[model samples]
Target chain A: GAGVSQSPRYKVAKRGQDVALRCDPISGHVSLFWYQQALGQGPEFLTYFQNEAQLDKSGLPSDRFFAERPEGSVSTLKIQRTQQEDSAVYLCASKRTGRETQYFGPGTRLLVL
Target chain B: AQSVTQPDIHITVSEGASLELRCNYSYGATPYLFWYVQSPGQGLQLLLKYFSGDTLVQGIKGFEAEFKRSQSSFNLRKPSVHWSDAAEYFCAVGPKTGAGSYQLTFGKGTKLSVIP
Candidate 1:
């Protein structure tokens, strides 16, 4: 079975540029989550979605960070006007409706120069 | 809100030696606890979790954890560790509420090194 996967595994962007990171959750997964991980630190929650409805976006750092899972499958995290502090790895995870565990994607590593 | 602590930033062990990783959490009630392993350029992999019932819980790759409510700790252990076990370990905690279970707070992570 294919686990969650993220695109643009490595991205280098100039400061003030906009970047979009994509996530493909597992088939039939009802819960999806996004997390940000800085160097040598654990992942921090960013947002969560149940199906197409985003139930939580409390962890998003600022207005520049936006996420959408319109059709209840693919998700995208867009950062507008990237800054040096925005450089980090963005991870996606998905869980089944009745499962307590979440499967994670390899993650997208973004570097803002 | 729940927070977890991994006291050891790094641990070095010889192959076949026993391994134990300490984890402590701060929460008002019994929280949902988990251990995850991450290799370079890979996603976090679930090692084990503690919800309720018996304190000891078993997980994949010969890993086990014991939840101690008295100490607010859920430490991961293995009888004998393999060289392949070298990776970063994370301890996470979440509220026990119905809706808050999905929001996990993770620790700083402990890097494990195995000498063959």
Candidate 2:
């Protein structure tokens, strides 16, 4: 793809429902990242991956939030028992390698009602 | 640990006026810095980045930033503001890493409002 692509650009889920967001990073990109952006706020780092290895999950807010990059090119972020507070835009980014500037996707706007 | 702070939550500038957005970061060693812009309802787009070498770095859209180690700041500046330049600007610092780790710490963005 030309750039990072995220699925379900807009999602509305009832409270307590589980939702999954997907990301397809640039092909062969060595580094991928996930971020959460609340309304009127900047994106906050959630997790990072180097190839198929999940090197950093320190930014995941809680056990309810989980992410995986099984094949290294595609990633999924799962939120269990979503709450209203989970309403925010989920962003995915990719970089050619670590320590480089990231290219972001259009983001998935999740609205937990 | 690494963190970023964008003091001005909102800034309004007239078209053709010079613009500046303040950013401060905290990290132990030399940190990689970046600035990104997000237009309304769009994804984040990289403005500029500073890794090493010169303190002043030029970026797209006629934007530039200076990294000051002593002040722990990397402020984005543009000589003239355009109406199309109105957007949310973010400042980010890369987390400490060895070789294959990639993480970004971002500050609450400053919203740039252009007044024509």
Candidate 3:
């Protein structure tokens, strides 16, 4: 695709529910990133993937947040037992290389009730 | 720890007036600074970045930023403001690169409101 794309632009989940957000990065990009942005705040780093390798997961907020990229092209971010505090905009970005600029996608806004 | 700070939480500018958004950072070495704009419910759009060489870097959408190492600042500027430019602006700092290391630390962002 021309740019990074995220699915389910918005999601409303009840507390303790599970939800999965998908990210389709630009073709042939070697680096992918996931971030979480709370209301009125900057986007915080969540995880990173260089192709199929998941090198950094230090930024993940808790154990309930999981991300995976199987073939290196697409990725998924799953949050289990969602809580009200978990509500935020989930953003996905991709870079041509590790040192290049990242292209971001329209975030998926998740609301937990 | 590396971090970026945007002092102003909200700024209002009149249309056709000059604009400047302040940003400061704390990093060990030469920092890769970036400016991004985000409209409501939209994705972030990169305005400009500073990697090396020239301290003054030009970006898309008639925006520019200067990286000042002495004060540890990278401020974004525009000659004239437009109503369409009203949005949230973010400042980010990150490392150049190395395998298994690619993360960007962003500021809380400045909300820009343009007056007609």
Candidate 4:
């Protein structure tokens, strides 16, 4: 009954610093998604994975944003040389195979100073 | 490209009053629509989703939504809203890609405020 969970609920990074956000999806979930949400805005898709395969990375803003799900369970979103424009909440969601509904995690709030 | 729109940026309603939140979407085909609620510092919670068949779908917390194909709209409603219903509501559309994958596009979100 465990839902998706993210680590470092709050992260404060200086400009030009790199940060890594972690996510743990539900057990047996085959599909994972990452989204970015700005203040007073809805979440926007960033990337998607299906069992260790990165299916979609089109939503990623730039080369600085990279994600990987190596073992098909845990996922990590990395941002290199964090910038003020990159400050936002990063959310993780997971869904079972053949299911449309996705369960979301608490999200990691990243602030660039 | 698929997109969702929430016309109302904010709505205020009294407790026990009926409530309705408007949502519109634009897609090439019949898209999968969903309503999600989010509290402050929390993740999104699914309210209801409309795929096919019935135009009316019921969800948790006494929430319901009606999908109108002609209008390209999926509006959320409740007969009587509780104070706890005050939160941010989002409308999203999911479109299937050529690779057999699905991607969701969400609206700007509507903030609901309840008064006693």
User: Which one wins by TM-score: 1 or 2?
Assistant: 1
Which ten-residue region of model 1 chain A has the weakest summed lDDT? Answer: A95-104
lDDT by residue (B1-116, candidate 4, tens digit) is 78899999999999999999999999999988999999999999999998889999999999999999899999999999899999999999987434445778999999999999
Residue-level lDDT of model 2, residues A1-72, one tens digit each, is 999999999999999999999999988888899999999988988999888888989889999999999987
Q: Candidate 4: where is the Cα deviation over 4 Å?
A: B96-100
Residue A44 displacement (Å), model 4: 0.5
Candidate 3 structure quality by residue, lDDT tens digits, A1-113: 98889999999999999999999999999899999999999999999999989999999999999999999999999999999999999999999873558889999999999
lDDT by residue (A39-77, candidate 4, tens digit) is 999999999999999999999999999999999999999
TM-score (chain B only), all candidates: 0.96, 0.95, 0.97, 0.96
Is model 3 an incorrect, acceptable, medium or high docking prediction? high
Share of native interface contacts recovered by each model: 0.73, 0.80, 0.83, 0.73
Ranking by TM-score: 3, 4, 1, 2
> What DockQ was computed for model 4?
0.79
Error of 3 at A61 (Å): 0.9
- Show pairs that collide, candidate 3: none
lDDT for predicted candidate 2 compared with the true structure: 0.92
lDDT of 1 by residue, B1-116 (tens): 57889999999999999999999999888878999999999989999998889999999999999998889889999999999999999999876667653778999999999999
Best-fitting candidate, scored by TM-score: 3
**Model 2 residue A112 distance off true place after TM-score fit, in angstroms:** 0.1
Q: Tell me, by DockQ, which candidate is best.
A: 3
- Of 2 and 4, the candidate ranking higher by lDDT: 4
